[model samples]
Target: MSAVTPLLAAEELSFAYGPGQPVLREVSLAVAPGESLGLVGESGAGKTSLLRLLLGLSAPTGGRVVFEGHALDRRSAATMRKFRQAVQPVYQDPFSSLDPRMTVGESIAEPLRSLRVTGDRAARAARVAELLTAVDLPADAATRYPDAFSGGQRQRIAIARALAPKPRLILADEPLSALDTSVRMHVIELFQRLAREQGIGMLLVSHDLTIVSALCGRMAVLESGRIVEEGPTGQLLTEPQHPYTRRLLASVPRLPG
Candidate 1:
């Protein structure tokens, strides 16, 4: 564990669809300030369920989600609002994540308006432009709608929107999965730069170990709702102790040396 206080943490988090249908079991993980952590698992391994719980979209059957030092209180609007501002989310599908009806500028600025950020229209506009630039999008692109851009560009716009609130942490759920292979590395580089230069932490959830290795310093392998192994990304890739983790590593394609 990092010596610095964790920005977000799940303590013994467990969830279930019904009395006997448990989706998660005693899951614990932490993302420290400016740290990038990855959660790796197969389909139906409860990764999305855990994310929903962390995002406060769903209440956990057991355990709790903690931010900074305080336990999350879904009942408290103030707490949730503050949490929302500090921790933003970048979901997998950029095509569906963005609103086709809204202009790109409006979409990016929505958080500032909804979060009640203390800024007038001009200030907000400037912030939006700044974010667009940060994500390598042209200032003029903001005038267009989501459909005007390609998949990669749309993902950049989604990233810009996530940055509008100046979040301390970003929860990325399979952020690169929907992109073409040609663009995946670009997005990965963008994520690396954002975390390095902006001091933003991240919790990246993906089934692809290759993507996880590229972006995360540490990783946890989930199997059947349990974290079977975890460690530094390099160590986990080179010397996975669990059978599930080894199998996962073996599944990754490698080119001839």
Candidate 2:
């Protein structure tokens, strides 16, 4: 873990809307190669805002975002395109993230077409099927429209779309929060498998400590846009230093004795 370089990094990131309401201030974190770093916090703790800033979708008020040791900017069009392809984001609301007008297959293929990845439509369709199978979904799913799928299925489709570009870094913002327990377990397992097998670095933004503990090697707890505590998952869960961390953990339901 100490040997590899970071796949994604942010230094002293600050962002805000209008003149007031600063969402993030000096928030810094790094995700190592092929590693999973969970970002957990209560709602409005600036989790989603930070992700947008990292992806270059929203400019930081005052800080830099670096990916694969390269600062993210449009200085070179080709370089910026490569950075876009390298980093992909999966939003929490699949229903909204996906284009309702497009079929499942079309939605998945959009990335390849937009990126000009240089592949025939037939070949891309075939690859999409393979990805669906990898995610434990049916091939026929690609033929259906997004409206036909359930919440879990929609999330699966969204994940498949993100994987189409073969991104090195994936930022999943609460990808499994909407699903039932059974479906959430399946999605979490899929995420873990992808991290291990595909060598993909994932920045999973979630408020669920149990989910983070299951998937992330290390994590940071955010409070009012500040990382109050951060360490190995096991260490922090067993013995957290910050009061907010302990309070967050206590909020999770526990079984009877």
Whole-model Cα lDDT per candidate?
Answer: 0.92, 0.87
What are the per-model numbers of colliding residue pairs?
0, 0
lDDT of 1 by residue, 1-257 (tens): 84787889999999999989999999999888888899999999999899989999999888999999789999999999899999999999999999899999999999999988846999999999999999999999879999999999999999999999999999999988999999999999999899889989889999999899999999998899988898999999998899999899888889999
Estimate the TM-score of every prediction. Answer: 0.97, 0.95
Clashing pairs in 1: none
- Candidate 1 error regions (>4 Å): none
Residues 34-143 of candidate 2: C-alpha lDDT, one tens digit per residue: 78899999999999999998888888888798887878875677876788788889999877989989989899889888877736988899878988987888898888
Cα miss at 145, model 2 (Å)? Answer: 0.5
Best by lDDT: 1
**Which lDDT value does model 1 have at 59?**
90
Backbone clashes counted, model 2: 0
